[model samples]
Target: MFTGIVEEIGTVEAVEPGTDANGVVTDARLRVRGPLVTSDARPGDSIAVSGVCLTVTDLPGDGTFTADVMPETLRRTALGELGTGGRVNLERALAVGGRYGGHVVQGHVDGVGTVLSRTPGPRWDEVEIGLDPALARYVAEKGSITVSGVSLTVTRVGDDSFGVSLIPTTLAVTTLGSLAPGARVNLEVDVLAKYTERLLATAGSAGTAR
Candidate 1:
């Protein structure tokens, strides 16, 4: 589990693809260079890399760690799109007794969204993301959403777009700082909203059946 609060912005050191005996592509091994996260990392631990929870396979003891990316994970998240030296938002798993600064995050990417617009400010910038119409129902104004592993509030929502404000700190610390229009990003909607919608739908179905 994570809180969606980015601890540090890490760099993608390497993405090595593995192949099967038949020469078919199997999976990819990712090595991320994060001085802060790797300082305390260990094998078998979980790290949220760009909003995808990956198990730490090798610490390497060099301010970098390795994680295996399966084919299914590659298909479902934006991590596969990364290349060497790409910027990525990183957050360590929520520790016991830690303050919950951001909303609940599972490090599971629900889908991919594209940047639509960016309105810059002296101190902050408002970003609009074009999401799939199906995900609009899960987004609400003033609610929280995870974008590329950064926790932010939705300032507005539309049929296929939502807006978020990035403060100066966020711009300096995370990949969102350099996000441009048309760039793809990983998106995870509020889990509470999804659960509420599910319960309401189930109740409505039971009422209709009675």
Candidate 2:
């Protein structure tokens, strides 16, 4: 589990694809440079890479680590789109007794969202993300949403989009600082809301059956 808190902005050193003799992609490996997050890293540790939870397969030292990316993960999230020198938000698994700064984040990207617009303010920037109508119901004004591993509050919500205000610190310390219109981001809505929705649906089904 994670808290949607970004610990560092890591650089993708390499993305290697394991191809078979037939030139079919069998698997993929990613090398990321993260000084702070890799300080105590080891193999088998869980890390959130741009809101996708990946297991550490190798720690090659020099403040770098490698993780294996599955094909399904690639199809579901944006990790497959990364290239060498790309920037990614990195965070270690939320440890017991650690500070709970952000909202509950499983590091499971539910879907991809597109940056619709960005409005720069005197002290902050408001970013609007084009949402999938199915996921928009879980998001509310002032609620929390995890975008590419950074936890932020939803400032506004529409039928097909939502907005978040980014302070100077957020803009400087994470990949969101460089986000522009039409950028793709991994989005994880509140897990609690999803659970509630499921329970309500189950209850309604039961009532109808009776």
* lDDT top scorer: 2
Local accuracy of candidate 1 as per-residue lDDT tens digits, 1-210:
999889998899999988989987668999999989988888999999998999999998889989999988888788888999998888889989998999999988888999999999989999999998998889999999999999999999999999999999899999999999999999999999989999999999999999
Stretches > 4 Å off in candidate 1? 20-26
Error of 2 at 17 (Å): 1.8
Off by over 4 Å in 2: 20-26
How far off is residue 86 in model 2, in Å? 0.5
Error of 2 at 71 (Å): 1.1
Q: What is the TM-score of each candidate against the true structure?
A: 0.95, 0.96
| Cα lDDT for residue 87, candidate 2 | 99
Worst 10 residues of 1 by lDDT: 72-81
| Local lDDT at 75 for model 2 | 76
Candidate 1 residue-pair clash tally:
0
Candidate 2 lDDT, tens digit per residue, 2-102? 99889999999999987879998767899999999999988999999999999999887899999999988887788888999999999999989999999
